[model samples]
Target chain A: MRCAKRNTILLLALLLTFAAWTSAQDEAPYYQSADFNVPIIAGWQNQSANEAAQFHKPAASATIRAAMATGADAEAAAAADLASWLGLAELTAPVYRGKVNLADGTWHVLARDIDAQRSVSQVARQAGDRFIVISFLESDPSSRIVMLAIAQADETLETAEPEMDSALEQLTGLRLDNLTAAQARALPGGEWLVYQSETALVAGSLFGNDSYIALQEGTAGDLAALADAWRGTLLGFFITPDNSPYLWLGITVSLLILAALAGSFAWRARALQKDLAMIEQLEKADAR
Target chain B: MTQHEAENPLAVRPQPRLLRALTIVSALGFAGTLVLGLFVAGTDIQQGQVQRIFYIHMPSFFGAFTAFGATVLGGIIYLWRGSEAWDRIALAGVEVGLAFALINLLTGSIWARPIWNTWWTWDPRLTSAAVMCLTYAAYLMLRAGIENPQRRRSLMSVYGIFAFISVLLTLFIIRIVPDTIHPVIVGASPQNAQGAFEATSGVVVALLPSLLLWLTLMPITLMWHRYRLALRQEAVDALKLKLLGA
Candidate 1:
């Protein structure tokens, strides 16, 4: 009993020591988010009405002739002249012109004319890929404008490929161009292309812009998937040339270790408790 | 007689003169360390005055860990050797660990506000410490839940061992992995590098004495109270047995 009493006193002393240690630490204040702002161009508008009106006017016959004077193909000249008259800064729009080939069930054109006084009329055909163009007398130059806007789809699909390619190369260290035919075949359907140029028109009346020619085509699910695939491949390249197995193995091993440790500690504790109980029972019986 | 004396088989032992003397010395040590910790320690070049909190924070962590360690060792002895003395030690250590853990957490938050620029971070050390405190608190509750003294002690001893293992893991786990959330404790700032102490003789004079005093006094105070508690528990057990016999 005396020994037990001494042990009890020693135990109490240890506790008080711990308490004193805890109380010694200082309490400080907490900090929160600092106030700041990052400026991003949310929207823009063309303030010049004259430039907006010029954008609205149809391409003139004289402008088309002058554009074609360099002996450019008629379709190319038409697109160039229209682009130049519209002051289209982006050089990416492809020029395509074909007349309706009534004889062969295809569109064929012969001797099309566009000049300074002519307006370009554009009609999207019912068939997804077909478009019709009719040249007419130019409307008032001051009021005429080619209203072009960049749509969300144009942003996602048109500009995505080049960004995806660069991101993929950074992530995977594999040049997109270097992928072998077999490797390319193995990838989910979609071919990557770099954006050369793009142009849109801002008219006087419209609040948003409009794209004249947005060039991009791929059959992958969506822009996000393309981004993910690029990121994964890049990360995978760093881990291993072939990384699927390593990722799976790493996850599996960590979970297994955690589970084993938890289970063993629990089991041992329970076993110790059982033995202690048995010892106590035996002592009680002996005392009785 | 004090109210506790009514239920205690062994009345509160009169405060021993030697113990009281030691306590006074210990109190002096605690105060000295605190003053030194606050004023004399060189300001962290990067963290400035906030870094002073480290003195308290680190010691509290050490104290809590030590207490928990004692609990585990005591628990193992209680189970293997069936020493009630070990059980008493284990109980005292757990209580002490709980108190220190609380201090560590509170002080850590105070320090965190200025340095990490947030009151709380999901940093591994902080999270693990919190978990450890909760686990030990659970151990205390488990002990309280049981009516049988032997069962409570046995169960708590096992819990104490498990809690110690968790504490070890908590301290070491973050080091082996990447954790962006918690700022690295060591080499945290290049300007205020490790052991940023610029102690004059006066500061050291005050600090060393305070540390020694607190270290010595804490155990004395706690042990004194624990002795009283053990006596009460013994008396209560005896009374129960006597009543049963009657």
Candidate 2:
């Protein structure tokens, strides 16, 4: 019977493993570090190493880098990160510096033209002693592309139009009405609402009721590509909070409680032995 | 008196080979499952290391469920057959069941501290679980307070049967009450589930063994030990009474 029971347990273990394998959902590909995670952008050269998640697009002449930097503030941290990657001395003051507040935190959005070919756009926010910086660099001599994420103007009505218009006005000092609207284009990432003029091209995608839009100038047709990549990283990347202390605390308390329960049984048994000894002494006195 | 002691079901005897084996197996299995949950499982991408607490938090509740189920069964049988053995089992269930319930309740509170950003909430599921723990705890207190042996056994038996309702409520309240932040691992979670993550293969593999061990072996082994302890306690009590009369 015991052998049969053992065989049944082994069979059940096998069945459980099979069920788990079948039931498990396909986990999305993510570039994970001890501190954070970002979706691995498809068709990009993965240049990530150490503590950072970085991806490069040779076709678009762009490299997207997400990392942490030590500085006094968000803007300083962003500048520090850009300096390390794009050669700090070669860059001048940003053409555009603005701030956008999202669900996670307030982000300092800055755009810098590094010499003539390379242009860098960054979003930085302070997280504890360090700062989280995601920089989008386009080294193409022909065109400039800027990627930005902003909270939706209206929560109930989610369309990329308002944010697209705002981006055009803010980035190029032009209205949305100035640009001709193209047919809604479908991509592997999601639906893109594209707007372009003679010089500037704009494309935006909606994720979690927020607008992730890309602005490009010159002869580059990589607005759709940049928009898709930005949408993937900006919307999905999350800093996995360091909460291991709570886990350790939970484990320690559980073990302590279990040990106490076990110890109580032994304590009671010792007391029982003492009681028996007392009973024996009393019985001996009465017998005498 | 010796004949009466021989007739009593609560009489002390050498540990049965089956019970001894079960105790060893259950202890080893409990340790093994804990190791699996702590080390073998992959860290959740979303919730981080704190998510590991789910392995213990969920299974410990089920452990309480099994123990309390035994209590209800013991209660019913004791009532029907008027057997002291059944009453001893019922009493053992309350003590052992309460410990598991406490583990479930406190581990949840600790987990919530990091995830939900709060130590405690009066959500329907949380409230029901707390009330369930309290109800079983009250069983132990009331048992000690009652003077008459026959009366205490019958009263607590009825209490044990009714208290099972709290366990059921705690188990299913998240479903019955639509507005909740508590995430379900099986089906679609509620709209407002805080710190929810998908149950991937790693979660399932770690959870399955722990679930099986807590459900079957741990409670049964612990309760059987408690049953023997209760018998020894009763025997000592009877000796004290006889000595006082002499």
Among the numbered candidates, top DockQ falls to: 2
Pairs that clash in candidate 2: none
Poorly placed runs, candidate 2 (over 4 Å): A1-28, A42-47, A56-59, A86-89, A150-167, A181-193, A204-213, A220-225, B1-12
Docking class of 2: medium
Q: Which stretches of candidate 1 lie over 4 Å from their true place?
A: A1-288, B1-9, B180-224, B240-246
The most accurate candidate by lDDT is 2
lDDT, candidate 2, at A190: 91
Instruction: Summing lDDT over every window of 10 consecutive residues in candidate 2 chain B, give the lowest-scoring window.
Output: B1-10
lDDT of 1 by residue, B194-216 (tens): 22334434333344444443344
Q: Return the TM-score for each candidate structure.
A: 0.42, 0.87
Per-prediction DockQ: 0.03, 0.55
Which candidate has the highest TM-score of all?
2
TM-score of chain A of each: 0.18, 0.83
